[model samples]
Target: MEAKNPLILTVRLDERSQRFFNEMRIKYFPPERNLLDAHLTLFHQLPDTNETLEIVQNSKRGVFEMGVIKLINLGAGVAYKVDSQELESLRQDLKRAFADRLIPQDKHGFRAHITIQNKTTPEQARLLIAELSESFEPFTIIANGLDLWEYLGGPWKHRGYQSFNYLDK
Candidate 1:
């Protein structure tokens, strides 16, 4: 049997939001298992191909409207749900482009979010969600680029980044 090649594609957020999410992950996520910085995943397991790379490289940058903050019940953990039409549209475009290559998870509707904690007890997740939700607020985040990474089991290795160039509208 061939070993599966796990690749992750994600949207690169603006500096401020990126830092905020990363900090949250650092503070809340299980230190032993928190191998990756916070990120908004677009495709969980994309195939490594030139076509995929081209699509990311040609993607345009846009301002994503970060909607209300809601807690996601991850069963074993929780996440901060981020609503963004612009980001969803981009993901849809990519989905269509790689329709045949998409995995089952990627075939479904894209739910943009930043997972601050995972692989923990449900009770712990609920406590953190409640604590965080009290002060949560909506904000805007810039989708400046697409990031690709090779998922080496638990730890992901950086593969490449395709920065989006915004066109004057």
Candidate 2:
């Protein structure tokens, strides 16, 4: 069997959204296990090839609106849910472009989200969800670019980012 590649592709969030989500993670996520900042993953794993890079470079970046806040039960953990049609469209386009090389997880429909806490007790997850829900509100964030990373076991190594054209109004 061919070995799986550990490259991950994600959508880059605007500064404000990034900071906000990072703060949430810092507060809720276990410090010892939290190895990454807030992120919206597009593809969990893609084959390490020139074609993958080309696909990212050719992809266009657009603004995405954040939908309602909901709690996601991750078995023993939890996450904040996010919905974006623009992000879904971009993901579909890339899915088609890399259909032959995408991993099983990436081949499925994309559900954009940023995990705030994971790998904790179910009770803890429920408590955090309840706490966050009390002050939840919908918001919007700009999709600035596509980021590629080499998944180094737990810690990810930054590879590069392809920024999209932003038209100022």
Candidate 3:
């Protein structure tokens, strides 16, 4: 049987991008709730099983760049909007492969993003959105691999990681 703890899948960002987003998260997110480093979640729930691990580790995906298109006012938080056809294609491949196992959130529309702030007042969120928007410029971040994490109630535990079929630059 699948473990009760669910799995989360994310696109691994390059070190520089990871560091930059983590810094933003630490500066803006409520500390008590900031349990994870910055991440771009692709799937919120996957079965925690050896099969799942094998499937992920066996992936042949190659590294690619994704566009950081804009900043989103997440009502009570802020996030950087992401867009890339290559990323979308990857998600769709996984979606189809795990169609029967998907939760509603994962099964429905997937808008890729990396949240920088959360768990604050809506007013505070609006202010941040405004402040960040003033200097917002589109950028790109490299997607180098896939990370698997086991949900630990509020915090997450690293499960495994599979680098895409290319050496890191």
The top-ranked prediction according to lDDT is 3
State each model's CA lDDT, in order.
0.83, 0.81, 0.92
Candidates in order, TM-scores: namely: 0.91, 0.90, 0.94
Whole-model lDDT, model 1:
0.83
Model 1 misplaced stretches (Cα beyond 4 Å): 1-4
Residues 98-160, candidate 3: write the lDDT tens digits.
Answer: 889889999999999999999899999999999999999999999999999999999999989
Ranking of all predicted structures according to TM-score, beginning with the best and ending with the worst: 3, 1, 2
Clash pairs for candidate 3: none
| Candidates in order: C-alpha RMSD to true structure | 2.0, 2.6, 2.3
In model 3, which runs have C-alpha deviations exceeding 4 angstroms?
1-3, 166-169
lDDT over C-alpha atoms for residue 114 of model 1: 86
Output the TM-score of candidate 3. 0.94
Residue pairs whose backbone atoms clash in candidate 2: none
Better of 2 and 3 by TM-score: 3
Using lDDT as the measure, name the better of candidate 1 and candidate 2: 1
lDDT tens readout by residue for model 1, 107-158: 9977788898999998998898888778877666677788999988888888
